[model samples]
Target: MDQLKYQMVIQWSDEDDCFLVALPDFPGSYWRTHGDTYDEAFANGKEALESLILAYESMGDNLPIPKVASSV
Candidate 1:
């Protein structure tokens, strides 16, 4: 089974006119999704994240575990 730890955060993106989803500690893990409303965007973001995780796991490479969030 795929085993990796991550968290999802969905926020509004005015510039994109879509939802901006991010994995706070997973750098470069983000996606822009469209939906009828904000709530749908959040839901879509979750699915997008799940798909990404699965794709990475299928690569047979070590899954990077997120430890903490940072700004540098």
Candidate 2:
């Protein structure tokens, strides 16, 4: 699957003292995963997104349309 088509939002949380990752296109929890560092959060987010796609496919559900950036 083309994972890049989806958007991944990563932000650092001072309360958690870690980086939080969110897959806005997947539709579920606001924050899907977290990591101690930015790189780790990115890797974890990618894995979570791939798993979500497979889960949706296995359940015979249509995947969400990826949002694209509009030209300014």
Candidate 3:
């Protein structure tokens, strides 16, 4: 299957002392993973994305539609 392009929001968290990652496609859930650096956060986010897709597939669940950015 073609890879789904999910939106990943990575931000620095003072409280957590690390870069936090959020998957908008799977809302309402807390941040799945974090990293000490931006690059690490990005890499972890990609891995999490793939794992999520595989999980939903194994459970026969439909994947959420990726949010598209609207040009203003």
- RMSD after CA superposition, every candidate: 4.4, 1.2, 1.5
* Each prediction's TM-score versus the true structure: 0.59, 0.93, 0.91
lDDT of 3 by residue, 1-72 (tens): 346678999999999999999998885686988999999999999899889989999999998999989999
Better of 1 and 2 by TM-score: 2
What 10-residue stretch in candidate 2 is worst by lDDT? 1-10
Show where candidate 1 strays beyond 4 Å: 1-5, 32-36, 67-72
Ranking by lDDT: 2, 3, 1
Candidate 1: residue 62 lDDT (0-100) = 59
> How does each model score on lDDT?
0.65, 0.92, 0.90
What ranking emerges by TM-score with the best candidate at the front?
2, 3, 1
Scored by lDDT, model 1 comes in at 0.65
lDDT of candidate 2 over 6-57, digit per residue (tens): 9999999999999999999887788999999999999999999999988999
lDDT of 1 by residue, 25-58 (tens): 4446355455557788777866776766677778
Tell me, by TM-score, which candidate is best: 2
Q: What is the lDDT of residue 59 in candidate 1?
A: 87
